[model samples]
Target: MTEYSAFKVELTEHVVHVQIDRPEKANAMDAAFWSEIVDIFQWIDDTDAIRAVVISGAGKHFSAGIDLALLASVASQLGQDVGRNARQLRRTILRMQASFNAVDQCRKPVLAAIHGQCIGGAIDLVAACDMRYCSSDAQFSIKEIDMGMAADVGTLQRLPRIVGDGVLRELAYTGRRVQADEALRIGLVNRVYADPEALLVEVLDIARQIAAKSPIAVAGTKAMLSYMRDHRIDDGLDYIATWNAAMLQSEDLRIAMAAHLGKQRPTFRD
Candidate 1:
């Protein structure tokens, strides 16, 4: 229920809808954005009533990436001393990176509903989500190469896992615009809708489905999947064994089993 300058956050049922609200700026990531995102997701992680999230942008586009003014501010602060500038810039980059890391690390499932232009840092943002869906008009690019810099955020690290090395390398190197169809073909998005309205409707419905599930099971599933991304299969199996040993004791399991046996709907307690 907290108000945010860069976003409009609303909770309905157990799903939280986070919309980037700076339409006049194409929902660009400004100074407020980087800091507010981390706070919002942290709150989502701590709230038991919230079970799922759908993030989308308001207006004509999802996002145009990091605000140019913000980037300019960083450039303007560079000192003549090379060592000091490097140290300052590195710290700044890490801070921005943590903003998206919050989305990646959130225990609740985060689904991105993208439309129109999803460029540069926008790619990095959506790449951190558990799932991505876009409108037919959506176009994505790894725009940092065109801006005379390497993508310093989560894109370079996380996207390769989502879209594979070959496709990611091609996009990163060329900065070519990938249309909605191509994005789906390359696995950048799970599905494409005719328009932003349809896109949000379906994605939010998916989030609702996720919210209806047992929160403990969903969290464990996300944790196991995230863990397996870096660990070996055997390690993942062992980890899950330890995980489920504790999770199995949750009352949710008994409630779910009783509902099944009684042929009735299950209602889980937060």
Candidate 2:
């Protein structure tokens, strides 16, 4: 329901659609854009009506990366005072990183519907999502190497988990543009559509499928998966047991049992 200068938010049937609106800049992210994105995810986290989120760009490109002006401004500032500027730069970068981290931390699932160019910061954004769908015209690149720095955002950490260590290294080291087909082959994108509109339709269909599931189960599963990814197997099992001990008693389970016995749909109340 909230509108931002760089993005727009809408909710329908428990799915929140977030679209980047800066077509003129190929949806490049500035400081304000990152701040808005963080706020949008926070809004989703606070709203019970929103069960899932779909992210896409408004025009031809999903995003071209960080806004060139923003990058120039950062570089200019860094040159002004190396010591003081370095700390400020780190803080700014961490804030931007948290914007994407919020997506991963959000209890609801997030699906990225990408098209055209998805470069640099855009890669970070999609990497933070639970799922990704793209159009055939989409192109992906790490781009930080070409920009004279390493990617300080979430991509360097998350891309390896999405793909593999080798592929992540190759992409990060070379900064080459990977087309939609290549991205699909590398398992970078979940599905590829003929175009943006088709991609959006498919993504929404997927979102609806997720929305129909028990919210407690979906969120618990997401949490367990995230935890397991970083923890040892024994630790993960212990954590899952502790998690399920509390979650198994939810009304959804009772509804599910009744629905199975009666051969009817289970209606869940938020």
Judging by TM-score against the true structure, name the best candidate. Answer: 1
RMSD of 2: 1.2
Span of 10 residues, lowest total lDDT, candidate 2: 73-82
Measured over all alpha carbons after superposition, the RMSD of each candidate to the real structure, in angstroms, is: 0.7, 1.2
- Give each model's clash number: 0, 0
lDDT of 2 at 239: 94
Q: Which pairs clash (backbone N, Cα, C closer than 3 Å) in model 1? A: none
Over the stretch 42-159, how does candidate 2's per-residue lDDT look in tens digits? Answer: 9899888778899999889999989999988877766566788889989988888898889999999999999999999899999999999999999999999998889988999998
The lDDT per prediction is 0.96, 0.91
Candidate 1 backbone clash number: 0
- TM-score of model 2 relative to the true fold? 0.97
TM-scores of the candidates are 0.99, 0.97
Best by lDDT: 1
